[model samples]
Target: MNYEAFYQKSIEKPQEFWREEATMIDWDKPFEQVLDYSSAPRTRWFTGGTTNLCHNAVDRWLPTQAKTPALIAISTETDSERTYSFEQLHSEVNQVAAMLLSLGVKRGDRVLIYMPMVAEAVFVMLACARIGAVHVVVFGGFAASSLATRIDDATPALIVSTDAGSRGKKVVNYKQLLDEAIGLSEHEVPQVLLLSRGLVSTAIVDGRDVDYDTLRQAHLGAHVPVTWLEANDTSYILYTSGTTGKPKGIQRDVGGYAVALAASMKYIFSGKPGEVFFSTSDIGWVVGHSYIVYGPLLAGMATVLYEGLPTQPDPGVWWRIVEQYEVSLMFSAPTAIRVLKKYPLENMQKYDTSSLRTLFLAGEPLDKGTSEWISNALGVSVIDNYWQTETGWPILGVATGANGKKVPAGSSGVAVYGYQVSIVDDATGAECAANEKGMIMIEGPLPPGCFQTIFRSDQRFIDSYWKQHGDRWLYSSSDWGIRDSDNNYYVLGRSDDVINTAGHRLGTREIEECIAGHEAVSEVAVVGVVDPLKGQIPIAFVVPRSLEHVADDAGRAALRDALSKQVDNRVGSFARPSAIHFVEMLPKTRSGKLLRRSIQAMCEGREAGDISTLENPEALQKIDTIISANHG
Candidate 1:
């Protein structure tokens, strides 16, 4: 069915709709109520049900698909690869589950995972789910202080890490970083399981640290039963940096999360039982937890766990993997596509990408230019989806060609089944007219797969989201957006990032998109800086298609003027950037989100807050130099 029909039926009968969707997974005890909203902000889904996420993702697939490949892991820098069948994955999960139990880990205990994107990391996550432990995954590159903040907040009983992690060509000493974080945290972790991926030179604590491989070997052949948890039982707690300078833990429930992710696999991704799916996301992020680990496995498909960047060895690494594995569907952030766009078109022609069916982009606002470029480069349908960490799955996405849906270039499509998105005025919280820009809000009770509450901060959850709309009960997405005449939703940048220039408000995304349309520009970020006349004038930092242009002062100046003209024509003169600086790269998070705040800070000659999440810290100094020279 197409999205129109599916969405109509879902909204018309949400209770019956979600209840029917819950039957897709295997449950030890079925739910009595499909949704419960008596507690206002803390809405519960599939109440009165009992289920195990590990059983649904692994054990149920073992009998019929025992020999089928369930996971494909690729290491880009080392050119190493491995595959695991459903039977093998189940056995490894059980072994690790047994090991966690031996270490005194029990139901509802928090287990922090700080490792790279490896097969063992996936196994550890599933093992924690199997034993009913709430897993907390911190990104591998996070600094000790960042890790310590999460450790103190969650107070995990045990921490799982690796000796080292490889990204691109650099190896991060994860064990050493974990040690520093543990020392920094006030909370006392009882045990640490260190997986020796390569060397054993890292110092291990006498009583607290244990080798993961040794523990797994000792627990080999042990039988561990899956723990059936209530529908409201916490499945995982993922920490996300908030605007308030504190990391907030997002809590996901067992039964509802599994049901929602399974449904999303079928509807959003068009994934089948045995198709190969690859989502280029690290296991630390929410996308990895849903699409990489749980979603594909729940759909009974082979999920690719890649431990490399898209442009690691060359620009053709991702396409080569697609051809090698015959990947049917792929999902990635727009930042990767923008980076790949820098290479010549001949680079993509070297590999056969015919096996790739549909390409999905998420995690940030995708510009129309980048979306069209990727579609033409890969010769496949590219779809831009919209969602957040609080929402476990996609709230907005285009349907695949199989569903007879037209993929819009820049729009995030219509709302998915079971979600009601509305554009409302920021001041009054009143619904806006069509094609009018306003704050994006989702009317609740939110569907399954959405977060339940902020960990240990019910009031904060209410204050941050619900309180904004007063008695309306709308979940504030904190994003600015516009709904077109055809019901297509276009996400402007974050509401806070909107620039006020000469009494006119403009979105940074619009200016960035206009500048990115230039042939010489590969990626662009626009931020507002204090101005004497216009209050705050927009300035842009652009990455040229070729570094040679950046080295040539004359070429850089000419290109900047051309980009300014392009923005003025597409948007308005008020939206044109006052100054444009050609840079080597833009600061970004590992998950591919542009660190606009960091750029804004650099422009104002101030310290960027909490830059520990930056994927390339070295780029900040370059940005500062470019901004200073241009301003002078």
Candidate 2:
């Protein structure tokens, strides 16, 4: 069948369609049903099936792919490289599993992972899967407070961390942050496993901390078998920022997730076994979980786990890996591409990227300008996809599918199969007209591989996702999107205040709260401003309790510097505001609601539209003057 027919079958005959697709996965016990939607918008796919993610990703491929390179790990920060064959990976994963067992970790327990882009992190993840322990990976550089919030939520049985992780020449003290996070959390962990990178050192906490290598050495040559799980059993939890100012843990299931990723590898990426796959995303994000680690390995491809910035050690570092590994498939983000646009093309062209078949970009909207430039420069297909951390996979994207869909510029392509995607009116929840903008809605029963529910909160999942638009049962993406005549979807920015900075979705409320915590500030509004690079950046305007703190220009500068550092410590450095201006008042409406859109518009030098209800005109003018003076 062609792409349209394939998609129609998925919608019209979901039972037959999904059953056929489910064959791509390796299930220890076949499913009795393709889908059980009796309780949907909460669905359970491939019910009655038993499967192991580790077996599909590693052990099952051993007979055929054992000798081939399964994982290639590189770190420019440490100037090191290592490759593990499928057999080697299986053995190491087993060793790590044994180590976890020794630490009292068991099936269904949670292991909080705090490490960088290192091979050991991958081993621990696979090990957790091998023994059915759910792993929660916090982004390595997040501050103590952010980490502490996740700790209290997941309350892991164990924490796996490293001494430090390097960014450029600077080393981030991972142990310090983990120690602080543990101290702040209400839950007490039983054990902490440490991977001493020796890049930096810290005193191990006597009774709690244990050396990772020592445990691995004791369990060397051990074989830990896969722990089979029912299809609907929870696999892992990933935390994503919500408007409520706290991160929500997105729960994923076992069998359905495996089948979804298997189909993605074949139809979407069009990657073959023994070929190389490269994704420049940290393991902390959903993309890394799906593409960087699971999907490629399940397809029997060699996946690269890379560390270090794309520009560090020169812009050629990424391309060098591509040329060296002969990476056949690549996945990255638009923000990274935008940053690369500034550098000379020769930095990329010098490397022979002949093996690269397709380059996929996601996490943020892909603009036409950047899309066209990168496509022409690489002389390859640049496919853009759109999805959220909650979704766990793309909602709208282009792939080498049955129809060989033609990508329209500035759009994220058509909706993938199994998604009953529609552009709908925000207030009324009615479907929109052709070429009209609306909230992207999924009718119900979110496709396989999508999040099962919010961890520890079934009601929150229903309220936050299913019934976001009041009484509407549709799944609101909470993002503004427009559909073309051919059904190509263009994702405008987030409809809410979540800011996508370099593909990291940060809550504006989180940053504003961090800024407001400053004793010098009484009120603050944080807005995401447009950027030529990095997609968007946070900008803050603060109202001080006393002008004495910023009585002069020099005083104001000092206050700004202080607030910037405070955000760095309270949040992560990536969340630090690009600029913070001390203002006597923030622009507000007659109802005392802050005019965040107008504030953002002024920062971007755009027209502030429909401000008749704006109560304070001078407040906006003050911001305009501040922005103008900075540019002038």
Candidate 3:
């Protein structure tokens, strides 16, 4: 296949080009048109086409290169490694699928998958696909109550999980959580498929559940092999990160997902056959579904899955994995970078990371501080890629840098082909000038891989994204960014995180950077707390290098004054934090981004649900104390 020719044609006539690309895979039936944009935000792709993702990702590859390495699992602990060839993966998935069939799972039935980064998790996902079951993957760290809510909501026929999964040296007991979560559910409970990694002696079995090993043995000779399905069917139901209310399940089709994913693999990762592409994000996140699973697998490249935090037993764990796997492409989050930076540089020097080539960052706004450090310390060029769960792949990325073009440190590079990117004022809905901050909206008929609708709430999806600026353009992102005269885009923080005081608009990230510039401050989180005087006032939660100084009122005042001065010099007086809470730590998500909402909730003395994802949940309690002492 001439991928380059297809990409070039896709840029010219996307609809027609995509129709052609859709034919590359085996389809149960053909479609009339590649796309129909009759509806604004909820356009359908491959209008009448039918194909299956499992056929392309696993089944097709099984016949040609079954002996080739398909997956590389790197544990967070030092020197934990496992590799599965296409044949091994095929056999595992086949056995799992047979077990699922024995348990009465049928085509189109939903399956809820909740597990850590273990290789069995991937095998389970593949098994679901093999048998035409729609799978929903929940992150392993989610609170049991939250996990149970999703399971009850989706009402899947089967739930697959492990007794325990290791993260660094810490063990997550998913079985206990699973039991507690489903204890109160009145809905029909799904049959449990359990994997006991190190808990063989402690295995708990029930009439409604089957042990993973036993299930595999029962299907040893019952392997029916993976078969192809139609493309237009539901591939999987991925629940979005629900910060608002209940997480909305986003249903994606097989054909569109496969086509859009192939483009992303080619253009975004510059992936070629047999290349090793590693992403640090867990399968729970959307990036993991696209880049880590479907995309690389469809491109005929090897995908590496890291099962633990970047800093487990040591800070150099990820670097060592890259050297050991010979990973050519690496993708991770900015939060991981910050955690690693806290470790001694000497620890990182012990590993050889020369195999890494292109480095990509996503999930949150990448600060220049981390970007520079990655480029200088790792000796790999860093590229910032932008996309949402709904956008499918890299709608905007630094594509030219695939050849080593040095883009300015902070820019997300120019818009990739097939996207019309612009920054516009929220109130007026007009494009903003160069260097002016505003909402970033992509003008498009909804592309393939974009979500069809927010599972049960069509109006919510429309109200959240489409209805913002008339009904013509789809507004999928809440982030703010600016384009320079050179047409390079620099992402600011989220629009909701933008602080407005005394007629001046300031980004929380800007204030954060200024506070971080101070020698005494270790880390900072800026939030617009409710105030009677100003509509909302910016507050700083600081993590000081030395608690001895920060614990005192005088020292706290001095540091606050210094941070105020720095903010004024860097951005302006309006951007300066009105109050600074010198605390032991700041609340953050597991992925490592500071949680402004958690801080806001704590400051307001409200509940912060599911702190299970936090690397340090206890940090929030300390923050609450500091907030109360200051406000009281």
Best by lDDT: 1
Q: List the residue pairs that clash in candidate 1.
A: none
Whole-model lDDT per candidate? 0.88, 0.85, 0.76
Evaluate model 1: give its TM-score.
0.97
Models ranked on lDDT: 1, 2, 3
lDDT of 1 by residue, 73-159 (tens): 999855789999999999989999999999999899999999998888999899999999999999986889899889999999999
Off by over 4 Å in 1: 242-244, 401-404, 468-471, 548-551
Using lDDT as the yardstick, the better of models 1 and 2 is 1
Instruction: Pick out the ten consecutive residues of candidate 1 with the lowest summed lDDT.
Output: 399-408
Better of 2 and 3 by lDDT: 2
User: Candidate 2: lDDT of 180?
Assistant: 93
Q: Measured by C-alpha RMSD in angstroms, how accurate is candidate 1?
A: 1.6
Query: Which residue pairs does candidate 3 place in steric collision?
Result: 50-231, 51-230, 51-231
**Which tens-of-lDDT digit does each residue in 1-632 have in candidate 2?**
77878888877888888898888878888889889988867899999999999999999898887999999999999999999999999999999999999889989999999899999999999999889999998877567878888998999999999999987667889999899989998999889999999988798999999999888889999998789999998889988732224669999999888888888888788988999999998898788899988999999999999988888899988999999999999999865775566577999999999889889998766666567778998899999898988888888886585565877877888989888899988778788998776788898777899998999988889888875445335898988788888889888656777688998877676677667667676667889998889999999988886779899889988999888898889778999999888888878543234778888888988988646435568999999999999989
